[model samples]
Target: LILMLVMVGLLSLILGMGLPTTANYIVVSSLMAGVVVELGAQSGLIVPLIAVHLFVFYFGIMADVTPPVGLASFAAAAVSGGDAIKTGFVAFFYSLRTVALPFVFIFNTDLLLIDVTWVQGILVFITASIAILVFTAGTMGWFLTKSRVYESVALVLIAFMLFRPDFVMDRIQPPFQQVEPSAFTEALGNAAEGDEIRLVVSGPDFDTGDNKETTLVLSVGAGSGEERLANFGLLLLPEDGVVKMDEPSFGSAFSDSLSSFDFYGDDPVQIASVQAPSNQMAKEWVFIPALIFLAFIAFLQRARISRQGVPA
Candidate 1:
């Protein structure tokens, strides 16, 4: 996976050389995302998948401003008569946020729309946006007031809370108690047919009534035992009625009528109860804290530069 991602990043960077960020993302995503899907990861993780591509795309664009082929830097230097390297560095620093934003959304599902609840999602959006603002302000040293190191840190922490998914709060509350056997029995009885005889048995053993089992008994009265036995097997009880035969008997009158009488078979008695998740809650949870982290980093960078008396 790591090797594949590296190759994808390299390809995206190579292809992104002169393309706009959005165009570069589209091109690489179209070309490489299929390969990832084939590898068995969910398609929903596309945000992160595309983020890697975009990271390479950003670097590819930066290559133009980095050194030898610094076209944008050269153009600016020629116009302003400034040093090309310095101009390139300035541009790179100013656009740092662009490179970081993708990572933020990629790591945080709330930002990327993974298993997010409406109220929680909204809260995440609001907090992350504020964190971004704080980060930008700290970086530029141009918010309502110049941000102190501690203030920047606080802002970052707040952003982290906003972007991180609140698992405790986001958890889906189960709407009902576990299904009881009695309930299952009631449901089965309600669904039983008129001719069916319901026997409640216990345990995993079907032969011994120790285990719970529901049996449907059918009786055939009109045919010879041999004829009935030919059509359907019979269960016989001893003359004393204390013991029942383990296997079907062919000589009984009941066996004779077995052909004329319809048997429900072993299907209903073996019905297994099903348990389903509640429809009221979500199956997944997404954390929004990532956006805050991005904002925090951006703000930290800005603050660090400011402390050095440098323009962010």
Candidate 2:
């Protein structure tokens, strides 16, 4: 999956060089994601999927601002007669923020709308925007009083928080806390409600062998006594046909024969739940090494600046 995604991104970037944004998305999504789907990855996660596609898309466009075939820089140089390589470098640096944005959205689903709440959605937009601003400052070495080393470090830290919304950051140093009285308060209030609701298993099917196998379906609900707004069926499977209901008070009760086996094993089941955290975390693990690498670059840049006595 990882290799496939990377290939999609690389293909998109290479194909999208000098293409407009809309054309890039259309071409890549039409070509790249189709190939991925044919290979069996779910299409529902297409947003992040396309985000990955766009990561390479933007980088491909950025090649126009880089050397050798730097079309945009070449055009600008033709008008000004400045050094083409220097012009390309300047253009690339000036446009670096645009190049970095698609990667952020690809890694952070809040930006791409995966399991995002209203408040969380808002925080993501605000923080991401601010992160872009900070990135601009860091790249240009201009912010409140021409950002110094510590200030650059602070900007990078803030950008990290903004780029990735993790539970650890929420608990310790929430940037959204200072937004407004209602923002954080409402988010906490919703958090108290807990977005995920657990549904208890009930009834039995004749497919089990000894009836010792128990089946339970976990679902989201309004509250303890309220009817479930959505149905996310069975969490487990029973080897036997008999099972007792433990928590009938949770959601609607149903008893039916197990569906035919198809996708997984001899018995097939349809899953309607949101993407699991384990899966998400695993996917996100790909970005950790990349993040560490970027952080190292920042650290090296800071050290170099310090040595030169330049305001970082």
Candidate 3:
């Protein structure tokens, strides 16, 4: 996933070079966004459409700093009396310091402030600001003063942990338990009120008539199994011990997608897997250890600064 995204970013950068902002955005969005969306689905990743577009946009804008055709670099060179190509190369390397941000937010949409409460947004902003600063310090090889090689590496790791606390938590405990499609009702009933259940369904596409699978995260409200499914515009019928989709109710959330499904046809739509959210500790708990590690690095840097009589 990371390598594919990196390639997409590089492609966006190359395609966007020398283009104006609006044109660059249009080109990347039209050409690259769908590629990302397709890649994400193939990887079983539920990437938000907005995230994919923003990812392309971020890299597209980086073209301004890239070498050879960087218009912004040419402008900067005119003002600073530097070589245009050299300035662009330097700027491009500097821009790479924050390059990980787009990738970070792609996997962690909360960083984009999507679907977050005001308090959560504020916390995200604060932590994101600190993480960026630490990341910059790490990459630039200076915090209080020049850093040791190990300190720089540790700083980068700490910054990553701060940016993606859940990465560690996910490794420790998988986020979801996959349930069989036939047993989706049982899983839905077992979930707590208002919790999310990820449903995977495969069916023919409405536009292209090609077979495609999509993932939907439905909120399971307090109700019986049938009622909960009805709330999401899904009606299931059991035939020979296998559950099949029925025509969705009018104007319901799943109407558009479910409407195309032919329950009785040879290639009828079917539920693939139902993922129930697992019980795990809050991801924020990881911040504690990350901060502790940051403090340790800070202490070491401070000691170096004291020994060298360097001003912090």
Q: List TM-score per model, in order.
A: 0.41, 0.48, 0.86
Q: How accurate locally is residue 208 in candidate 2, as Cα lDDT from 0 to 100? A: 51
Tell me the tens digit of each residue's lDDT in model 1 across 144-236.
445667666665554444444343233546422233433432322333232222222112333332323222222322344344324434343
The C-alpha stretches of model 3 lying farther than 4 A from their native spots are: 202-213, 235-269, 308-311
lDDT of each: 0.47, 0.49, 0.85
Judged by lDDT against the true structure, how good is candidate 2? 0.49
Clashing residue pairs in candidate 2, if any? Answer: 208-239, 208-240, 208-241, 209-239, 209-240, 261-267, 261-268
- Regions of model 1 farther than 4 Å from truth: 1-15, 19-27, 30-65, 68-70, 109-126, 140-144, 166-312
- Greater-lDDT candidate between 2 and 3: 3
Q: Give Cα distance to truth, residue 29, candidate 2, Å.
A: 2.1
Model 1 — TM-score against the truth? 0.41
Question: How does residue 100 of candidate 1 score in lDDT?
Answer: 42
> Which predicted model would earn the best TM-score?
3
Ranking by TM-score: 3, 2, 1
Q: Output the worst ten-in-a-row residue range by lDDT, candidate 3.
A: 257-266
Q: Candidate 2 regions off by >4 Å?
A: 1-9, 18-22, 34-57, 112-125, 140-142, 145-151, 167-237, 240-312
Candidate number with the higher TM-score (2 or 3): 3
